[model samples]
Target: MSVGKSVRLFLSEGTPGGLITAEIMNWTGHVVAAPRSDLAKLTKRPEASRTGIYLLLGEDPDSVGGMVAYIGEGDDVSRRLYQHSRPEEQGGKDFWERAILLTSKDSNLTKAHARYLESRFIALATEAKRARLVNGTAPGQQPLPESDISDMEYFISQAQIVLPVLGVNIFRTTKPAKKSISPVTEVAAESGTESPIFEIVSKKHGIHAQAREIDGEFTVLEGSMVRKQWISTAAHTYEQLVPKLKQTGVVVDSDDGQTARFTQDYVFASPSAAAAVVHGRTANGRTEWRIPNGGINFGQWQTLGVENEPDTD
Candidate 1:
């Protein structure tokens, strides 16, 4: 369902670590990226003078593992950069620490095209929710000929593909991290189950979860239910996490108001973190998770080795 892609990156400073420009194979779209300190130098390039869209990137002050971004389009992107480089008192933006400029190599993009691209990009970035949008108001879409609109949309598709290769991932949507497991292996010897699905359940609290190790991260799949109320002794980190997850729709409440369920796949850095969230208290995920009704804990399975464990029969 997916195809291979080729991306070419040019280091203007001729080293592996500095200002760089990227372009996808057979694509007219171009992207130039650099740290805030190199803004003046980067804007001096000829491509910066063309009509284009740009993104300003920085950390989100309110959240960890998240970023803040401001997207804009300009007739002369270089001039806009110059303006943003001014002092705060002169109306310069203060939140950005890096800049990425998007333009067409063949100089075919028009003012209307850039505006439409800006609006569409903002919508996409908002939908991705990977970054906090700093723009107070989104730029409205601009009118364009239907044929030109199709071309611009194609340009956007290519831009999305190339931006990530350039390390500009503000537009990326979140997905569970992945790891591989052999397809034909048995999961629980007692039940003779061949499926890899593992679980954590608390019948008293009406919690039942399905999880797996994915690319070194412990992932809880969507629709798995978790405890609605955390214990009073829950860790401070979990105290903060539970509400955040609920607010973000990662966990949703049931009509009975007695439980909350995961709405989407979520990956945790460690199994303990996942367990703590699921049970609403501090827990040792290694010992808490088990092959459903199989009596073997994850820690035992892991300690003895997953694929190599002898059949219990």
Candidate 2:
């Protein structure tokens, strides 16, 4: 079951690209975010001086189609931001382009709490594998009172919910993109229900892959087969992703070394990317992917009830 959540966002500069603040209806946590270019202005904000955890986000030049993140704790977030804002040669990270600071409205968060959150977030981000973590290691969690631990856990859950809305998704460990779904005719559906399993098979290429559109992401399930090599005509955007997947261990060669299989369930930005990767070349995902044994392609199944096509049943 899911309940509605209200998030109040205020753009301090009255611009989407400028400094922004967010808060949940009943959450005491306050979030401040800004681009690295606005660091000077952000450091002047009162909340930037509070004890809190911060996340740095930017594209990873080293990894194709993924982002990099660094989680840390500080009594004065502005100070740490300045340190990281320096050049990498000065012992600072230069990869980040944006920063998000988390603090409490009542100033109740302490150094211990921030440290716990830093360690917890790092571990969570590592497990999610959504981004390459800049953290060298996960710090040990300090022991806190049982009640405080419970409170912080709730805080973490709330942060998880709020972060994604801010375009920060390093902690998204699951495939489901949205929490709810509309009812469809093939099978009874409900909120949070998994998408129907779909597959793409090509006996000629020795490829058989299973996938599902969880939430809204098109995810190729683990053990799905991929073509042996990407063709020259493969979509340029996703062509390099094939090798990157193999290098990251997301996909690996099978026992016979004839083709490859996905080591873990992987999400593609779209059905076409999933299809292109599975086929090792350019392909039409809507027509390529189909409901196994049902004979209906993705294009057909997804458009159900949209028109008054004569029933073939």
Top candidate when judged by TM-score against the true structure = 2
Model 2 lDDT tens row, 254-306: 88767899988887888888998898888899999999996798888788779
lDDT of 2 at 74: 98
Over the full model, what C-alpha lDDT does candidate 1 score relative to the true structure?
Answer: 0.77
User: Runs in model 1 with CA error above 4 Å?
Assistant: 14-17, 174-202, 209-224, 229-240, 247-258, 262-276, 281-313
Q: Which 10 successive residues of model 1 have the least lDDT summed?
A: 186-195
In Å, residue 20's CA in model 1 sits off its true spot by 1.7
lDDT of each: 0.77, 0.82
In terms of TM-score, how similar is model 1 to the real structure? 0.72
Residue pairs with backbone atoms closer than 3 Å in model 2 (clashes): none
TM-score of each: 0.72, 0.87
Candidate 2 segments exceeding 4 Å error: 175-193, 232-235, 305-313
Instruction: Provide the clashing-pair count of each candidate structure.
Output: 2, 0
